[model samples]
Target: MKKLFLTLFLLSGLLVTASCNNDNKKDKKETETVEKETVEVKEEKVVKTPTIVGVAAANENFTTLVAAVKAAGLVETLNGDGPFTVFAPVNDAFAKLPEGTVDGLLKPESKETLTAVLTYHVVSGKFMAADVVKAISDGGGTFTITTVQGGTLTASLDGDSVILTDAKGGKSKVILTDVSASNGVIHAIDTVVMP
Candidate 1:
């Protein structure tokens, strides 16, 4: 009877130990899961907002523009902290240029010209679509915007669209506007405007 009692006692102790181990394993697993969730939340909150150049680089529509920006060495300038208003031209807009024009401009020898052309599309301050319309209205149907390239672009309203006339009299219609970035705004234009 004593042996039996001893055996039952040992069995109970073993069962309790096994149960405690199981409970510990469960607690450990729960802790690991909670840690993973916390890490995931931290990762979600760590995402950085894109700048103007980053926004252009991430967009498929601005491939040509991004390339031109890089080629002209204006990536840093455009990416700087400023409320710039960029009249971004889409790939289709680049294609609308004369054949071999874009290639020539992208060449290293044409960096100055390319920079000027690119900067022509950028205004010094952030001007939302409404602000531009208001400026046009306040200017009596036309607003002259001084380009970063030291040239002038005339903004006017055509029916319901905003039109930008370049220094050389090229016209580009604003197709998309108010593309917000960390440093500026982008207004997509249907044509490339020359400086």
Candidate 2:
């Protein structure tokens, strides 16, 4: 009777230990699943969209424009809470200007002129490509946009592309449009539009 009781006790203890081990495995799996979900949520939250200035600064194609904006002291202004619409000119667009023109504009004494030039590229409100096209269609195939610098830019269509005619009667074609930013939008042009 003693031997039988001891054997029974040992078997019960082993069974209980085996059951606890199984429960531990289940708990571990649950913990691992929760941790995996937490990590996934964290990864999703890490992606952040930059502002207009930040976007331009991050892009290699906008290096010249970014440098000009910085030289003009418009970085802080552009980064403000404005829904500005910018007709951003790329590096090649800046190259289209006469030689030494960009260097001359970057001078400290040229801050006023540079500011004017930069501001001319920006409109006060956000105007997406669709809105611009619709406005052009409504205004007898041409839309006049008033710039932040108090200049006017004429918008018209040419083979489905938006063409901007600046104050100097120079033309720049919009190569890309609807680049979203935190405070504004950027429409890339093929040539620099002057005020």
Candidate 3:
């Protein structure tokens, strides 16, 4: 009888210990799952915003512009903490140039000229589409702004579009507007304005 009692007690103790160990394992698994979920949430919240260079680099249409910016060594300037207003020209805009024009400008010897042309598209401050429209209105139908290239660009409203005239009397129409970046805003133009 004593042996039977001892066996039953040991069996009960073993069952209790097994249940406790199972509970501990379950608790640990739950904690690990919760920790993993927390890490996932933290990763989701850490999404990085696109800078001006990032924006141009991500878009297929800006490939030519991106190359030009790299060749001109203006990538660092555009990527800097600038609240710049960039009148970005699309690939079609560069295509509109005469044959060999882009090729010639991209050469190492033409860096200065290319830099001037690229900088001509960038204004010092961040100007949204609305701000540009207001400026045009405030300036009595034409807003004259200084480019980063030290040249003057004239902005005027053509119906709903903004037209920019360059120093060399070249005009480019803004096609896409208000593409916000971490460093600035981009207005994609239909033509590459000359400096």
Evaluate all candidate structures by whole-model CA lDDT and list the values in order.
0.95, 0.95, 0.94
User: Against the correct fold, how does model 3 do in TM-score?
Assistant: 0.81
Tell me the tens digit of each residue's lDDT in model 3 across 1-195. Answer: 999999999999999999999999999999999999998988886556688889999999999999999999988888999999999999999999999999999999999999999999999989999999999999999999899999999999989989999888889999999999998899999999987
lDDT (Cα, tens digit) per residue for candidate 1, span 18-72: 9999999999999999999998988885556688999999999999999999999
TM per candidate comes to 0.78, 0.83, 0.81
Sorted on TM-score, best first, the list reads: 2, 3, 1
Cα lDDT for residue 39, candidate 2? 91
Relative to the unseen true structure, what is the Cα RMSD of model 3?
A: 3.4
Q: Which has the higher TM-score value, candidate number 2 or candidate number 3?
A: 2
Error of 2 at 53 (Å): 2.0
Q: Provide the lowest-lDDT 10-residue window in model 1.
A: 41-50
